[model samples]
Target: MSILPVSSIYLIIDLISGFFELLEYTFYRRAMITGFLASIVFGIVGTYVVIKRIVFISDGIAHASFGGIGLAFFLSHYLVFSFDPLAGAAVFALISAVGIGLMSKKKVQREDTAIGIIWVLGMALGALFFTLTPGYQTSMENVLFGNIYMISDVDIYLLSILVVFVLVAVFLFYHELQAVSFDEEFAEVAGVKTTFFYLFLLVIVALSIVFLLRFVGIILVIALFTMPASIASGLSHDIKKIMLYSWILSLIFVMGGLFLSYVFDFPSGPTITLFGGIIFIAYTLARWVRV
Candidate 1:
């Protein structure tokens, strides 16, 4: 009753792998190496992203970076300037994070509303600029829903360096992060720089989102960032335990989805997201039943 040729799909992937082995000296093989590195970085960063309750902001940052992507393309094409789309994305994402943090200080609007407005406006600007620039649509489409097979060795190196930076920063500030997440007022009274930690966390989330966009794309990056942590948080009582569980869970989803996609001729992003969603739902249901 299934429409898919499951067996044939596996055969095709096997053939593809064999072909890749034959072309092992080529740049395409380097792309796969970069992809693996990206996957690991996403797993670790995603844990903190979910723990901090910044899923909405992560989505906004990812979407907002589209404007930067557009600008990068326009500059590279029209202005004769060589620009890296990821670099531009990182810059804009950091700017957006700062704006979001400042807006949080105001009581006039909810944080969610501010994030939504920024998200839409950023996307609109991206679209407008893209339309004005020739040959921009193709580049935007790729950024919107990444082509994983195009990853490069340079990309892998950059991602690994960023991963190390994020991990070290988190390790150094774990207590402050935990305090701010649990209770901002109490954290401030206890001598934690709550505002600084909050801003730092948002900046990290923004950078993670930008890094992940090349692998999962803007549409599904939020799921990878939030779902594993959401499920793990439900099962763990302590923040440290939650982060540990979340990292394990994220790795499982990435490895499982990547393998399954290769076996089933499916897209990687949705496969990972779907598996994460299933696990999250199952965990929730089990908790409900136990309670």
Candidate 2:
């Protein structure tokens, strides 16, 4: 009443109500719901990824999944076999994850070299297969950049199942995985199955990449995975606490994405990714300055 003008207060209230009204749309609601769900995975897995310094591993798996998509399409169209691209993507992702883990564990090649080779090979295979497929491949556009509004009920169902799976799996092996993530050599010396947990962790990463493909595209998904945990790590040293903080931070980052997109007439994926990048960068700079 004193400092704020009456007109300004009404305008603010109008904007708030209008924004909530936008959520009434089915697509916007789904976008927000899936975004929130993805944040949970992002927080837990992202914490482990940052702790273990395996940020780019998910990138490779995500890219590699393209090959599976093409293969699934080819099989479905040419052989008339029923196949889901997402399932194919999950399969390819698991293969890539396991391959990377084994190669690094066995000292067969530099980890980055292995990842790069797999990444390109997957994309190349995807392109080749798509070219061979008969019709104009319109669906692939959604796969490349993501279209949250175009996400289906089936996608949400699958995402929900994967979230539950990830939670239960993490809960059962939290301590063992935590130890492996924080210090593999020490954990191995301490009688933990470092190799098993390491591979298991990568498997989780692979699954996450596949499920999150719709909400965030392949190119931008890594930032969401890497940044939330990195930010939480700076705030807290305790792993569990870091995950909790990261989850909350991820929730916040996703909150305004849809509204910004609606307002600015932009793609939902880039809006979300850019929003996250700004927050991540701000936190980094602030932390650096404080130091």
Candidate 3:
């Protein structure tokens, strides 16, 4: 007997057909390219994120990035020169990442509380600045929730540069990062600069959050960042293997989620998040039953 329910089997068939029909559009192709590029960095950085146990910090930084976007708008209007929102978001996220890292290191506030403070402050600042921005902010929802179908050629180019940077940086710093991630105290004793590497990792994550903002938005980006590595970790304990597996799983989830959204006329970002969640749940259950 077929393992899937009959209705699900039919739905798959329909999705396959609809997916092909939609592929003729330039937007769909761009979305596909975006997925491929984003998945690489997601898998790499996410592995570190999961292993280092910093998912919450990543979320805080990602959300905090919106303040940068809002500031970009304000600056453009306030100073009378064009300011890139992505640039604003990048700068904002970096500051948040450094702030969170420094605060967590200083012992003045609990890490979670520090993260929470930045998260709240970011949202508040973004809202205040956005309200002050002149005219209707046509792209506001896109920043909040993401719209994959609206990606442009320039966006793809920038994302491509990010993938290259993340890949090369990780490859060069892999041993130091691995050391610091697994043992801050030991790494420090062993001559690894734990503080520098720790903050460096967060900086990369900040950059990744800014670039990923366009695909899944601030609201949904954390799921995209964390889910792939979490799913891959369930399959392997080796960090290297986990990174590779995370990339493959990310590709599957992104393409599958993209096609499903298009086939059913669903909202892209949330649909992708839910799609990953379902697979994650089913995988966990299967593993539990096996154990």
Could you tell me every candidate's TM-score relative to the true structure? Answer: 0.85, 0.92, 0.92
Q: Give per-residue CA lDDT, model 2, range 1-291, as digits (tens).
A: 455688788867887688789789888788888988999989998888899888877789889999998888888888857788888888999999999999999989999999999999999998888889878377677777778877778888888988898899888999999888777899999999899999999998898888888888776778888888898999998988999999998887777676677767888888878888899999999989999
Q: What tens-digit string does per-residue lDDT give for candidate 1 at 1-291? A: 355799778777886676557446544454455445555555556666776677888789888888888787778777867889888788888999888887885556799999999898778878887888886666776688765665666677777777888879878988888788778899999888788888898888888778777677777888877777788777778766776777778778876666566557677767777877888788889889999
Error of 2 at 47 (Å): 0.6
Q: Once superposed on the true structure, which residue ranges of model 2 sit more than 4 Å away at CA?
A: 1-15, 134-137
lDDT against the true structure, each candidate: 0.75, 0.86, 0.88
Between which residue pairs do clashes occur in model 3? none
Candidate 3: misplaced stretches above 4 Å? Answer: 1-18, 134-138
Q: Report residue 63 deviation for candidate 2 (angstroms).
A: 0.9
Q: What value of lDDT does candidate 3 attain over all alpha carbons?
A: 0.88
Better of 1 and 2 by TM-score: 2
TM-score, candidate number 2: 0.92
- Ranked candidates, highest lDDT first: 3, 2, 1
Q: Write the per-residue lDDT of candidate 3 for residues 19-100, one digit (tens) a residue.
A: 8777788898889999999889889999999999999999999889988999998888889689888999999999999999
How many clashes (backbone N, Cα, C below 3 Å) per candidate?
A: 0, 0, 0
Candidate 1 backbone clash number: 0
Model 3: how far residue 276 lies from native, Å: 0.3
On lDDT, the leading prediction is 3
